[model samples]
Target: MPTPGSTQRKFRLADDALWAEYDQACRDINGSTDRSDDIRKHVEAVVAEWKQRHKMN
Candidate 1:
């Protein structure tokens, strides 16, 4: 078994290629370039946009 903080953290995806694509695409967001952080920022932005759209209804 892997020990704590002994591996590169990554999000689970349907396929390894998809994860690689996402990892490669992450450049920088609000000064953090980490892939996991990038994914979190993306999800946050999406949810924010969704809330804005729903509020208009």
Candidate 2:
């Protein structure tokens, strides 16, 4: 039998690989770059693009 939050846990596990890739890419790019400001700007741009495409914000 499953508990109330079991479905949410299963859903998250299914997408774990996707989230891992996103985090890894971000870390790699940020690591190769020396400027914190540039990293912040790039992350903001990516978030904005995702939001626009998904109509999230």
Tell me the whole-model lDDT of each prediction, alpha carbons only: 0.70, 0.63
Model 1, residue 35: displacement in angstroms? Answer: 0.9
Q: Report the C-alpha displacement of residue 5, candidate 1, in angstroms.
A: 16
Worst 10 residues of 1 by lDDT: 24-33
Model 2 lDDT per residue over 1-57, tens place = 346765531223368787667667766877643344455587899998998989953
Question: Where does candidate 2 have its weakest 10-residue lDDT segment?
Answer: 5-14
* TM-score versus the correct structure, for each prediction: 0.54, 0.38
Best by TM-score: 1
Candidate 1: the clashing residue pairs are none
CA displacement after TM-score superposition, residue 39 of candidate 1 (Å): 0.7
With a 3 Å backbone cut-off (N, CA, C), the pairs that clash in candidate 2 are none
lDDT assessment of candidate 1? 0.70
Misplaced by over 4 Å in model 1 are: 1-11, 27-33
How much is the lDDT of residue 16 in candidate 1?
85
lDDT of 1 by residue, 1-57 (tens): 347878764555789897676656664334434766676677999999999999999
